[model samples]
Target: MAPSKPIITVVTGTGAQGRAISRAFHRSGKWHVRVLTRNPTGQVAQALEMEGMELVQGNFEDKGALLRVFEGAFAVYSVTIPPWHQQYDLSMGEYEQGVLQADAAKASNVQIFLFSTLPYVGPHFMGLGGVELYDG
Candidate 1:
């Protein structure tokens, strides 16, 4: 059976921005928001699920998981969160994750793709430039 409304995949749907975006989409009563999160049991994730969003367990590090979440979706909205444990910083890692997400969207044949991530800034500055490359 097919869904009545078009689907939009929201990456890191438990985060602040993802939550707002998901809520906006859900409130529209149009797009079926399919949200991916590492911790589905988290309070925010649970709340979003309660609001009629489809919550799926997944992480940015896994391309296969992202591909699965993006399947059959009309659009994909991705937001990359900087990893706290990494030594180098989020510039390289965030760009890598964005690349993976973009690739997944392409493979899924998503018509509209939106990427929200910090770019590669200088050493001290936040990674703000690399994200534009990834977004491209």
Candidate 2:
């Protein structure tokens, strides 16, 4: 059988890095970029839509919503923003969101999962520990 074109699904697409990467993939022509954001009708989504890229609106808190976004996609770029910076008490929400993304990936028959994460200083790192990447 012939190989298939890669479908790139970028989670957290409204964020800075996700949008840049999505644009790069869309420009490369080697892959189809799908931008997944919480606001599909927001400014970024509207702009990306104008560029001819696919966009899905959903949040990590909703598993069914995530599964719908993951369906038929070959890969997913998962990103989680820490809530603490916003002075929210639920700072660990990122981890919870990651867990939901992981379950969605497993049930979606997806491969080639890519994650953009925080930098780690050494092999024995602490904190998030790239758990977002590992979970995906």
Candidate 3:
């Protein structure tokens, strides 16, 4: 008998990057994909469900929710939107969210914790055609 595929939990699964990651894994047919989303009734979430990805409704700020979603997962793909992105109402800083996700993944004993981040070059290149990737 063939062995079962490993499970991977993806944060922000309703977002573009998260959805892309989930789709890539789903296409491989090597791992079971589980996605965490604040809005399970949203279009992306509903589409992911139809494509055989498990949906877990939750928010990044809720530790209990994160723990529940990450529990017993082989890996976690975490991606947080930048603060400047008007698409999301960010209650906390991006770094803080990243730390929180890492902590939750650790607590849940998740083997692989993949975090997506952008460099903070705003301060370094203050006046040289300054472009802030993310503020706070």
Candidate 4:
């Protein structure tokens, strides 16, 4: 019999980076990938599910959901898009989501917490104006 694989919970699993990360882990055959997304029926979510990933329906703002998803997870990969990139308003700021996910991972005793973040160039960089960076 094959050994049981460790579980890794992935946040924003339907997005580009999340999809890639989840696929890599799933293809490795070493980790059981659990994906968290608000829409379980979305195309990307369905694709991942078909590939043997377990999907947990939830949003970042719901602490209870986050906690449930993190439970028994050996590692977590969290990635949140900027507000400007999102089509709808998020219940909390992007930074807040990061902090919340970290806290959830800690509470769940997860061994690894991987947070993907981008640097805010804002007005500091040339030709980048009118960009408001989300502050936790």
For all predicted structures, in order, the TM-scores are 0.79, 0.75, 0.83, 0.82
lDDT of all predictions: 0.81, 0.74, 0.85, 0.84
Candidate 2 structure quality by residue, lDDT tens digits, 1-136: 3225678788877667788878888899888788887788889888988997888887756789889888888888887667643422343477787777877877998887776554322334455345455333
For residue 21, give model 1's deviation from the true position in Å. 0.6
RMSD of each: 6.0, 7.0, 5.4, 5.5
lDDT of 4 at 40: 99
Candidate 2, which segments miss by more than 4 Å at Cα? 1-4, 85-92, 119-136
Candidate 3, position 63, lDDT? 91
Model 3 vs. true fold: TM: 0.83
Between prediction 3 and prediction 4, which has the larger lDDT? 3
The runs of at least 3 residues in candidate 1 whose Cα sits more than 4 Å from the true structure, single-residue gaps closed, are: 84-92, 118-136
Error of 2 at 62 (Å): 1.1
Alpha-carbon error at 88 in model 4, in Å? Answer: 3.6
| Model 3 stretches with alpha carbons more than 4 Å out | 1-3, 118-136
Query: What TM-score does candidate 1 get on C-alpha atoms?
Result: 0.79
What is the Cα-based lDDT of residue 23 in candidate 4?
99
Check candidate 2 and list the clashing pairs. Answer: none
Candidate 3: residue 79 Cα off by (Å): 0.6
Tens-place lDDT digits, model 3, residues 18-98: 888899998899988999999999999999999999999999878999999998889999987678766778888888999
Residues 56-86, candidate 4, lDDT per residue (tens digit)?
A: 9998777899999998999999886676664
Q: How far in Å is the alpha carbon of 97 misplaced in model 4? A: 0.9
